[model samples]
Target chain A: MKRIKKLDTPPRFISWCAVGGYEEKNGPLGEAFDLCDESDTFGQKTWEMSEGEMGRCALNLALSKCSLSHETLELLVAGDLQNQCVASSVGLDSFGAPFLGIYGACSTCTEALLILSSMIESGAVTTGACVTTSHNSAAERQFRTPLEYGGQRSPSAQWTSTAAGSFVLTSDEELIKNAKLSNVAISDFMIGRIVDGATADGSNMGAAMSFAAAESIIEYFKESELKPRDFDYIVTGDLGKVGTSILRAILEERLPSAAGKHLDCGNLLYDAKRQDVHAGASGCGTSASVLASYFLPRLEEGEIRDILFLSTGALMSPSSVLQGNTIKGIAPVIHIHSSAD
Target chain B: MDIYTNEGKKEIIKKFTPKTKVLKNTLLAFIFGGLISLGAELLREAYIYFGMSEKDALTLVGVTLILLASLLTALGLFDRIARYAGAGTLVPITGFSNSVTSQALDAKSEGLILGVGAKIFTVAGPVILYGIASGVLYGIIYFIYLYIIR
Candidate 1:
């Protein structure tokens, strides 16, 4: 295999696990998740604490699945939608590995994976875990109004998934041999740029993020010298129904042939017609959980060979929104290949 | 085709923006607002039954509702109630109280005087200023109409 030298050598997945709350567990992809709690609060005191617990549970599940202890893990790279990524920090605090807290909003799952893979390729860490989480109550309270407030939701608004996904990566061949493996490897990645669509409305996240996803996908195709048909699926992170439509339209103009392969994690995360989620599911966990529960397993089973995982994020804070700053969108793409391919 | 252009970007974004559910929201507002008003009326009647005058009972009811709204906002319950109630929760005096209290709570992390104290009126500040101004203007007009005309 010819490796993209700039991106680094591909890192293989040792084990991955997805854990979700009640709403996500009841969704279409519910059966695919490794673990789920019936309660949104997960017996925690606050919604933030519940999110933290979900992250911790995902990491623990991933670690136990690989039969590796927390101390044996080289590093833990994780993030969440909460301010300061407190969910990840507090959730993974018990683990002995060095921690790197990152914030990419809803796209944090891919961002964490990209960083972990790069570290593995650099030979800096032989084994590392990437985790991302989001909670509905925590996100709602921070971004908009509290869930208790009877605020009318806009049709374009997405329900933040109360979920967490964790992936453990190992560069050591010996470790991979002993572990139950998915045989899915991260072959390459393209860091996305902040693309502003000149949108100032915080509620319209789909519009804010669609342009960035389209721009990044086009860039990935150009940089990899591959067409959209090259991958079995080109999955985007957290662009809901409306955002996906917007992205499809943009791609039709920019990369006309590639538009057909486009799929959005947000749109696919929930049953929109049955579920109250008007646009679709969003938040970092939306993409993370879907990948961990659905696509990663499909890759493992050789049902799919090559897939482009493009996670998009709206890099905006409540404070920034309050200050009238436009929401800047970002989308980072990672190429995942199954060993069978 | 170049979505990077201002016009193209705007056009595409507009297509994806979902419209507000005005009908459902209005219905919710009406129901919730009516319930809150009913509660206020009940409180006013209770105060009158306890030997308070009608005018004093009305004043007391308004203050009590404001206090209840502020308490609910602090407890983080008001927002959740407001979600389903929509303008129902917002159209009443309690809604105004919630706005002020919620902003103050949000800004509480910044510090006392600079944060909560300064930001407490962010949403309600304009309403208070305008409300007092209009009240004064109407009072002067009424005075002119009664005394000067007589």
Candidate 2:
């Protein structure tokens, strides 16, 4: 590890950005959230979009902003929180990018970014797009019983924010140079460990995300060999308030003495119980949508540096959990570069 | 603004460039759509908190969902959710609304009975057909495999 004060950012990580969402008022997310419903009082606003339409909107947004034709992309790797990658199916139909539907639960965005950046960085591929979107309505139907079925939620549960978000990543030199996002560091650590067949009831996502987030954060520290204060921010996936506290307490209990600033997408998205969001944010799209609304601009503005983004995912299987199979979690960190020459 | 398929409205706004309008002038769309699902959950919780049976809760949730769905479709709110939330908002019951309206509107262009009455059933028709067909296929396959194995 050479101590280079101000390392010149790499040419490898240059990507374009595009956003679409239903407008919200007075909230950071409101400005960037892509809308699908106006009457939906809870987060499933976009429930009217067929899986394909949502993806198409996101892809078109990315295309329009990047000014890249559909033919320009070598491959479009994307996924969604919908069961069996249904949303990705929608984006796949029209976008014509070679499709890759991924489901690492809510970690889909970071996961897509991981693979896309690696492909571009290593020169295995070029001019690729990595995107993921979560439609609130689609998710509610699949995970919870039908919205019409009106199901009870536990205190530990987090409401799914009605939103869809996406980003396009590439190794194109021109875009990176022009946009002023120079250096890029994709964290080499992939939290691929499972809980050795430990079973837990995770009907509510907070508990599930908490366990996974805790493991990844702890291991990221060990793997990167850096303290909490090394980076300006450590953003976790949508672990709303309760899970945020549980995760921090777990970390505190684990380290007993570690300290610094830590935030979760769920906690940062809104004012906990009082604001509309919820107690513990849990969803594959949670981190992605919120980050698009909040984090992306900050990176471009040079307000932050070296974001140690640990996107967390909880892998729960239908038979595995009921038949007493263990739940697994993965958290992969990437170093985001937003500085210029 | 009907989202699931192409509509005459899209033709009317063929040159409208909804990208900016869709992105800009729709705060209520974002807030209400985002919160609607949460509201459903909260309603369910309110029911359960009063010790409503899970079966009863399920019924209440269903009624609430359909009512929301009907209200949303009637007020044209579902279109906004479809635009903003993308699949995020559209994945749930609001989708059912769109399905009904999309088919009905399409059928209206044809005629009442054949169009509205006949076409409406077309909604989820393929899904049900495929589901049943697949189930039968699986049943046959399972029986054959069981016989072969035994």
Candidate 3:
């Protein structure tokens, strides 16, 4: 097949558990549209979900286990991985904390991290909550193939993990404050701008999304601002193996400054290590799982510190690239404080 | 209501002659169309009194009604009927059978393999499915009373 890579991410959270039950996504395009037309948000009505309505769904579940509320926080800055950034657009519902929306691709979580830390030190908000998620079937159905086409998947691709991931950005007081997080006073950090990353044909998403992972991470610490050794984990969303090695080499050469601190959610998920995926992770939920499931647990346990989390995204849209076009991409890097010990 | 003399009358006569929707099939359609339909309608009433199922009664009466239509179709009665009482000859069951069989006859010159052989089955697909479904449901009821009860 011709290498035609395109992506459109819907509002994403870190869990598969959130969307599947809302509607049974089945069938080909005409019928699926027919069913969803009467069903989920991707179903019947509007595309953008209010932050309180959606945020509370993900946060309320995580916070129920964490014991947090809206009053004790610093800032609630969230953005959707979807168009108009509506997925994370309405992040200002209940917590009353100042919120912001930024587009950095499926790499949105990292962008959200950059803002939370900025607010923490600038005295804007002591605590901050960062959230991002991508619905697999919803995102995929809207963007790529029909759900039932379960055709042969290329080794160059990674299975989009079904999960929603969220994190509490807070000071030392409470990790989750009223579902809003206190600022994690980062001892050392810098906001990294995307300069140069992978230029591989994203036709194989695993490769393309990973190229983004590699280039962004290398450009980040090299240009301004921080040492690679300053942080423990540098995670990228679903870069599987194809792009991970690509990311590793580019970083080791340019920013030999932080080679060992790299961690990629793409390659680490499952099949990314064995050159199994022709490309790497592509969806918003790809990193959503690792941030919420893998990284946050490690953060709470003090196993990692000075965390530098970045979700890599391929901003190639179907319309622009379909008619033979490519667009520039952006990745945001956030340096966070995990634990006091 | 308005009056017209020689020249105008000629144009009016030509217009009326071309557009007349006259049902002029005095034999194939008019007489048989009347008699067969009347017979089916009468038999339909008589059979219902004698306990004929609506489904079978519709089918039986339909065969007679469409027999009239197929004869009319064969004798070129339909082209004239197409002009008058527009769809009367088109509605009955025999009309559907007449459509397929007559088209087959018309295209028979194309050879049996391509025309007649292929034509009867052209309208077969949907009929096959509905036939199978109706037969299965009826068969199940027939079996329950005869085989199961025994």
- The candidate that achieves the highest TM-score relative to the unseen native structure: 1
lDDT ranking from best candidate downward: 1, 2, 3
Worst 10 residues of 1 chain A by lDDT: A1-10
User: lDDT tens string, model 2, B36-84?
Assistant: 6788788889999999997898789868876666676556565545544
Worst 10 residues of 2 chain A by lDDT: A2-11
TM-score of chain B of each: 0.87, 0.55, 0.46
Off by over 4 Å in 3: A1-55, A71-74, A89-99, A171-185, A192-202, A209-216, A219-231, A255-261, A271-280, A337-339, B1-150
lDDT of 3 by residue, A47-107 (tens): 2342224444555554444465656545665655466766654534555655676666676
Residue A52, candidate 1: C-alpha displacement in angstroms: 2.0
Off by over 4 Å in 1: A1-8, B27-53, B56-85, B97-150
How big is the positional error of residue B131 in model 1, measured in Å on the Cα after superposition?
4.4
Rank by DockQ (best first): 1, 2, 3
For model 1, how does the per-residue alpha-carbon lDDT over A1-341 read when each residue is reduced to its tens digit?
Answer: 32233445578888889999888888899898999898787778777889999999999999898898998788899999999899998898989789999999888988899998889888999889999999998898778863444356777888999988999988887887787784889988877788985677777788889888888888777767777888898999888988888988888877887788888888877898888888898999989999999899999988998898988899998888878887899988888999854
TM-score of chain A of each: 0.96, 0.83, 0.68
Model 1 agreement with the true structure over B52-75: per-residue lDDT tens digits: 999999999999999999999888
Off by over 4 Å in 2: A1-28, A34-49, A179-191, A196-199, A255-259, A274-277, A318-326, B1-150
Worst 10 residues of 2 chain B by lDDT: B9-18
